[model samples]
Target: MLRCNLICIGKLKEDYWRKACEEYEKRLHSFCRFTITELPESRLPDNPGKAQIQAALEAEADRILNLTANTFAAALCVEGEPVSSERMADLIRTLSLHGTSEISFVIGSSFGLSDRVKEYASIRLSMSAMTFPHQLARVMLCEQIYRAFQIINHGKYHK
Candidate 1:
């Protein structure tokens, strides 16, 4: 089975978000071995300066990189290439065919990811140009990943 790991920063404190993630994870069981690893987000003040935010993102990147070792890394960022659901499914299939059974997706905190993280990514994916709450992003990503699997399998869940 393919191993899909979602390495995200920050915890999902909302019940709804957790429930939503759990649902997708359950649905994905037949497709791939999935795991969600939440890393600690760097603390910042109410009004942090650019430098401080950059520093924090760098720190988070270090942790993310460490956790994603030995996997094909994909970083979720606003500047990343946006793809349709079908394309995502194709990408997943291609990776699997290439013998990359382990795929890791990195989701940065509110301040976003550092350059180092982006550089480390084998592919950069963007959900949208608009910003979303990190917790909610996790749920969305999980759903999309499940949908991708369904699409690959020609299952009705994706349609």
Candidate 2:
């Protein structure tokens, strides 16, 4: 089975998001081995300056890199290249052919990812140009991953 990892900064504090994520995770188990890791978000004062936010993002980037050091990393960003479900399926197949059974996807906090993290990504993926809360993004990512698996298995999801 394919091994996929998700590294995100900050815990999901909302029960609804947690439940949604769990549901997708359970579904994904039938197709692949998945691991989701959450890192602590840097504590900053309310109304923090740009510099402070950048510093926080930088710190999170360091932690994320270490967490995903062993896998091919993809950073989720607003300006990243978008791919269709068929394309994503193809990409997964290509990865599998290259003997990269393990792949890691990283999502940053509300402030977004640092340049260092972006630079390190093997690919950068964008769900949409519109912004989404990190919690919702996690659920969406999980669902898409499950859908990707379904597409690969010739299941009904791609239709």
Candidate 3:
């Protein structure tokens, strides 16, 4: 099975978000070995400056890079290219065809990813041009991965 990893720099503290992620994980089991790696988010002050945020992002980036070292990392950021469900499905299929069985999707903290993380990514992906809470974004990414697999397997779950 293809290994799909969702590596994020924060926890889904809310019950609803956790449930949503669980649902997607259960759904993805048959399609792939879907796993989530939640790393700790760096703490920042109430009015942190650019340097502070950059420092935190860089610190978080170290952990993210270590986790995704062996996989084809895809950093999820606002500046990334927005991909549709069909394109996402195709990307996975094509990657597997080319012997890339593992793909890691990284979602950064509130300040977003560092330059190092983005630069390390094989592809930078964006769900939308609009902003979303990192927790909600995690759920959306989970759902999209499920949808992508549904498309890949010609499953009826996707409409």
Candidate 4:
């Protein structure tokens, strides 16, 4: 089974987000063993300075790096390459065949991923250049992951 991890900063507190995530998670079981890990987000005052944001992101990056020590890392960033569901499925298939036991997708907090975190990534994947709340990003990622499985298996969900 493919071991896929979603490492994100902060908790999903909204009921709708939680429910959405749960639905995709249940569907993901047929594709991969999914692990969702939450890292603490720094509590900064409103209108934080650039330095403050950078520090917070650095702290979050450290947590992510520590947790994903033995897994292939994919950093979610606006500047990264955006791949199609079929392409992502093909990538997953290749990784499975090549003996990649685990894969981690890192989603940063409000200010986005730190430079160090981006450097740590084996691949930088972008859902889009447009900004979205981290909570929505998680739900979107989960759905796409499940969709990727459908594409790989030639399931009707992909049609």
Candidate 5:
């Protein structure tokens, strides 16, 4: 089975978020081997300056890069490419067809990903034009992945 990873810098603290992710994960079983790798989010001050946030993002980016070095990396950020569900499905299918067995999607903390991480990604993905809490983004991503699989297999869950 293809190994799909959601490498994010933080954990889901709320029961509702966790439960929602769990649901999608459960649905994804028949499609691919899925896993969520939570990396420690860097500490930032209450009133962090630009430099401080950049430093923390860089630190987190290092860890993200290390884990995703051997996989197809996708960075989720506000400025990333806006793609539809069909496009996402196509991306997965195309990657799999071209010898990519592992695909990693990276979600940064509050300040978002560093330039290094974004530059490293094979594709940068934007969930939407509007911003969302990182925690909620996680759940949304999980569902989208499951939906992508359904679309790929004609499983009647996407539409």
Candidate 6:
């Protein structure tokens, strides 16, 4: 089975979000060994400057890099290329065949990811053009991953 690690900033504080993530994690068991590692977001003032945000993003990137080392990393960003569900499934399948069974998805905090992190990614994936709350984004990514696996397996869950 493939091993998927979600290295995301910030924790799920809401019950609904937690439940939603747990549900997808459970569903994904049949497809991959899924794990979520939440890193603490950097604290910032009410009106943080551009330099402050950059510093925070760089700090977060350092943590993400350590966690995702040696894995096929996919950074989630608004500027990333959009991919269809079938395309995502094909990418995963191709990666697996290349001996990259461990895939890591990197999600940044409100400040977003640093350029270095994005540069390190094998692929940069955009869930959509619009912005979403990081917590909701995490759940959305999980669902898409599950859907991708289902599509790959030719399961009825995907239609």
Highest TM-score against the true fold, candidate: 3
Off by over 4 Å in 5: none
Q: Which scores higher on TM-score, 4 or 6?
A: 6
Kindly list the per-residue Cα lDDT of model 4 for residues 1-159, writing each as its tens digit: 999999999999999999999898888887889988888999898999999999898888889999888888989998889998888888888888899999999999988899999998999999987888889999999988888888888899987
**Weakest 10 consecutive residues of candidate 3 by summed lDDT:** 149-158
Residue pairs with backbone atoms closer than 3 Å in model 5 (clashes): none
lDDT of 1: 0.92
User: What lDDT score is found at residue 126 in candidate 5?
Assistant: 98
Return whichever of 3 and 4 wins on TM-score: 3
User: For residues 44-77, could you state the per-residue lDDT of candidate 1 as single tens digits?
Assistant: 9999999999999989988999988889999999
- Those runs of model 2 whose alpha carbons end farther than 4 Å from true positions after fitting are none
Write candidate 5's Cα lDDT for 1-159 as tens digits. 888999999888999999998888888878899988899988888999999999999999899999999899999999999999999999999898889999999999989999999999999999999889988999999988988898889987777
Global local distance difference test of model 3: 0.94
lDDT of each: 0.92, 0.88, 0.94, 0.90, 0.92, 0.92
lDDT value for model 5: 0.92
Runs of candidate 4 with Cα error greater than 4 angstroms are none
- What TM-score would each prediction reach against the true structure? 0.97, 0.95, 0.98, 0.96, 0.97, 0.97
Report the C-alpha displacement of residue 40, candidate 4, in angstroms: 1.0
For model 6 the TM-score comes to 0.97
Worst 10 residues of 2 by lDDT: 83-92
Q: Candidate 1: where are CA atoms >4 Å away?
A: none
RMSD of 4: 1.0
